[model samples]
Target: MKNKLAAGLLGIFLGDFGAHKFYLGKPKTGLLYLAFCWTAIPAILGFIEGVSYLLSSEENFQAKHGRKY
Candidate 1:
């Protein structure tokens, strides 16, 4: 199971490299984010996603990611 705190922090800090995506077992999506990382879009989006993750209800997070925080 994924740790929401870890994932959220990774998304906020290392998300430009798609660290959170990798942690979530999404290698393909992680690669896509890495490919576009130089554009800075991935970082911005990652930050938003990180915030979303931090704010999400645990049940909702589990339902979406199929794992517990």
Candidate 2:
């Protein structure tokens, strides 16, 4: 299972390149974030998402972003 704390940190620090999304197994979304990173939107979105991930329950994070078995 993916860890929320790790994902949150990655999102906060490296999410300009969609690091957290990749960690969460959402490559398509990750790629999109990376593709548009030049606009600064990804950075802002990443910080928000990082905070959201940190605030979310483990069950909610897993249900939304965990890898499929």
Candidate 3:
């Protein structure tokens, strides 16, 4: 889950390429975010998603994305 954590943290800090999405096994989303990263929307949204993930409960995460480990 390190990747996911990194992605969420980095994504919020540096989500130009949807790093969080990539970490979550959503390469397509990551690419999409990367495409629009220059606009800075992805970065903002990434940060939000990152924080959400960081604050989310383990059970919620597992229920939503399953055991990525």
TM-score of every model versus the real structure: 0.90, 0.89, 0.80
lDDT of candidate 1 over 1-69, digit per residue (tens): 677888899899989989889988899999999999999999998899888988998878778775545
Could you tally the backbone clashes for each prediction? Answer: 0, 0, 1
Name the 10 consecutive residues with the lowest summed lDDT in model 1.
60-69
Error of 1 at 4 (Å): 0.8
Q: Candidate 2: deviation at residue 32, Å?
A: 0.8
Q: Could you say which candidate leads in TM-score?
A: 1
Clashing pairs in 3: 12-47
Q: Encode model 3's per-residue lDDT on 6-69: one tens digit a residue.
A: 6558767877778778777779988999899789788789888888877887767767765544
Model 1 TM-score on a 0 to 1 scale: 0.90
- Report how far residue 11 has shifted in candidate 1, in Å: 0.5
Model 2 per-residue lDDT tens digits across residues 1-69: 899999999999988899999988889999999999898899999999999999999999889878767
Q: Which is the better candidate, 1 or 2, if ranked by TM-score? A: 1
Off by over 4 Å in 3: 1-4
Better of 1 and 2 by lDDT: 2
State how far residue 40 of model 2 sits from its true place (Å). Answer: 0.8
